[model samples]
Target: MADSAPEVPAEERQEDPDVVDRKAEVLAEQIKKSKHFIVFTGAGISTSAGIPDFRGTEGVWTLMAQGRQRPSAVNTLQAVPTATHMALVELQNRGILKYLVSQNCDALHRKSGILPDRISELHGNNNREYYFRAVASYEKTVHDHRTGRKCVRCGGDLLDSIVNFGEYLPAEPLRLARNHAKKTDLCLVLGSSLTVPPASGIPETVGTRKAAKLVICNLQETPLDGLVDQRIYSKADELMTRVMAKLDIPIPQFILRRRLIVQMETTGGSRHQLKICGVDVDGTPMTFLRSIKLDQYCRRAACIEPFTISFRSDLDIGTELKLELEFMGNYGEPNLEIIYSYTGEAGTEMMYLLEYNPQTGEWKTERQESQSVDEDKKPTRRGR
Candidate 1:
């Protein structure tokens, strides 16, 4: 009789088998033809869901491994579901989903409404406690083994179902996830940065095993970004909303828009034309007519008007005006008055009548312009 089990020599096993398997082709074709699919999600996905994911120096896992306790799950539940979670739920409800595997211990997947049976909680839930045991299919024994008795299975200390740093993956879920990878026609990965082991290896395993067409969706760039067949850069919530629409699911529509405006004012001096040069709220000069006048004498009467001014060509604010005035009677120096008006928004206008005393060689304001509700009339008094 031939040896009951023919053993291949170790030398023969060294030869590489055909790397190109028809299974990969078949899986790809099946994906094009069929609808059933498996999805493996990562921490990156939950970030949009408002639940923190871990694994990097900044990741939730990293913090926990560093002796920091994870936040309570109650807060996560109160937080709103992200577009990514809604999309996953839509995929499951439409029956396009075969199963979902998540490494998160936050239990957010369940809270998002995916059926427990359809999801493989790879890392287990943080809320309830249990310990890993068994071989081919690891068994989880409840934390409160029983008030009536102790842990009968292993009699070892029961622990939380959550897998931690330095802990190996629970066997059963890992096995199921592998089986799903080998058989799946389409594998959609969402939000995971795909850095950590065992889980990160899933995409490569599926590719190597001739399993499925891989689609990886994430925000920041990842190592597997170039390796996947399809890549999307977006928040989970928005991405899922689009996916749901494609599947004929009714989703609410929302968008954001904005507008702004600004205004300014400045004073101008001699030899310079007052020009509005800065950008306006709408990028155009304010609509208003401008008027300018020069070389006018205002010593005779209230000869100035609002939006109007008078200046001496040779003298500025303080220049001596020498004049010999022989008063026939005892009287003081003449008083000068100037009047000005402006009709525009935010009503503000003023006028000043001044005199240059040759005796003191100083300029003194004799009168100031004032505002009135009615149109101003010229002053009847004369100048000095």
Candidate 2:
């Protein structure tokens, strides 16, 4: 689909290290002085993570345009967040970056620990699925945008959120990005060629402001190169690493943290149904676990979702039930186990927080009791 767009020359250029350091110092000062700072990202920021860019010399689109085979690369799920992504998270955590607008659908920003409310993904995320009114994560490989799942509440079909060629950009993310662009005093463009519109027009909106300062950091020539206050031809990771150091902020490491909800429902007598599934921070279904096995019993649930195992066990309360969890292993996570004591209580639920550090090859799990509340009751909104 990227080949459908006009072919631009994929010439890459890099500035000297000293020049990049000087520019980073100036950018650091700009961020410190600005009241509202925002960032816009493109595919270039993700190339360091084994993902291919669309306009680079060996980019996917460039190869397709030349009638060459697309380069073999890791799947988006397996790609880790780059230094640029981690730096942005640190900037947001320090309250320096007000908002983020990304054209990439890789979902790296979210995976980097940026809150969902702090970013607007205009092109949609490949890892996300949308029903008529709800959005959820789709961890498996998506084909034709059909996730083969339906909305639990309304039974509507769920479609992958990736925006294809000629499709309109998401309205909400686009509107929020434009609003941030209008309000930002300092606009930082990272890894974007500024070729696609009306997403590309967002940076122009800020550049046209009289008091706003726009900076572009990309190896390729962008249409906005002439309009920016500062232009640095460098990789996003290199530039961002230097900028963060200048600001005295350390880039945080990427940790794969997941929340799983384990619930046991008493069907009747000694029979019970045990269910285990992964969920996002917002309680949306996250398909991270590939399979679940019950130890001792030698039973396993390898189905798509709603992983459940029903059995009539006369085991008394306090007896431990061990469950082996096999994850998708995108980051080399090993098989984990969860030991749950038979409560024999109806409507019992527990929450487990699983964190894995790829750099350290360590895994940690914390269990907490799940508090159940009435769904019919009106919920109270809390400030972010």
Candidate 3:
């Protein structure tokens, strides 16, 4: 008998080997017949924009979960933008992308430069802060170590501007997403493992319902694989390019710029304390370029807030000083750096620069005091 045909390599396998090509063809035909098309995206779509996936072999989430890395190392939406991101922006402009549902808190969907009214961020935006205002700044008048500040409108302690692990999902955005899924005739799932709660259920809800045809494009397989009417195992950028090409959508150019803010709060002995917050554009309150502190100048109990500081004249600098910043988690170790200059007079001012140290858990600072006999009148501390 003749030799059997040689096995095909995994790399050379058909795009959707698990299902017949005719199924996708039929779905596409249905899409053309339908009116409203919605896209439910995951982190997969952002990879083309140079943003790293969170759950792949070398992804941020996997590394952090496995103890090989830290959660703080995850990049923000603006930190990276993939080609697929630009394509989606174009789709939104063309009004073809009726609704976009995302599982990422990185805020990539919003960063694509989409209008807030058009996109629903299921997870809160990382660039902003949120908490019950009543609880955010409650101890302004109290002298206790834990009492920091009180709201002018209502007495409240300021809280960190992020969603904690045990926090409940915001309701309004979830409702909007569900409405989008219901009204959409076509649904696209991009670059998500689809394993997480709430978010994972979204794709299934859209797929099982006869209301929309499900098309999933991811680098890896998801639980929604069997439910998908169309599945493609291609990079988001590549898949988006093909989709846009077929749909005749033009891609836009992306210009990237980075802005950083630093907030230093000091509180300890003698009612001396400082609060520093800055950014290029208006954003949430908890924004900081990098967060670092040392055992010598700072300790966890010295202030009420983790990022707060107690004012000290000894921290002023007259010469260039270096600083290091580290984030929370096991991946980062102590980082070191040299500041070129730190010109300070009264030592009350700080200039901030945005930089990151992959090896540190907090920021490091150096102070140079002025030597001039009469320069003591001015307080000048540049934080970078």
Best by lDDT: 2
**TM-score, each model?**
0.46, 0.89, 0.54
Candidate ranking under lDDT, highest first, comes to 2, 3, 1
Model 2 ranges off by over 4 Å: 1-10, 133-144, 149-156, 314-317, 342-345, 373-384
Worst 10 residues of 3 by lDDT: 1-10
**What overall lDDT goes with each candidate model?**
0.47, 0.83, 0.53
- Tell me the tens digit of each residue's lDDT in model 2 across 83-115: 999999989998999999999999888888888
**TM-score computed on alpha carbons, candidate 1:** 0.46
| lDDT tens digits by residue: candidate 3, 1-384 | 001111221121236532434444454455456677777777667655455566666566555555565334435633545667777778778777777777666766655566556766665565543335234243553211232333222234433223434455567777888877777778888777777767667678888888678887776777788987777776666666665655556787553322322223234443334333333222322232245444544554222223344546544544333334442322233444434343333234444443333323344343333233322442221111
lDDT of 2: 0.83
Judged by whole-model lDDT over C-alpha atoms, candidate 1 comes out at 0.47
* All candidates in order of TM-score, best leading: 2, 3, 1
Worst 10 residues of 2 by lDDT: 375-384
Better of 1 and 2 by lDDT: 2
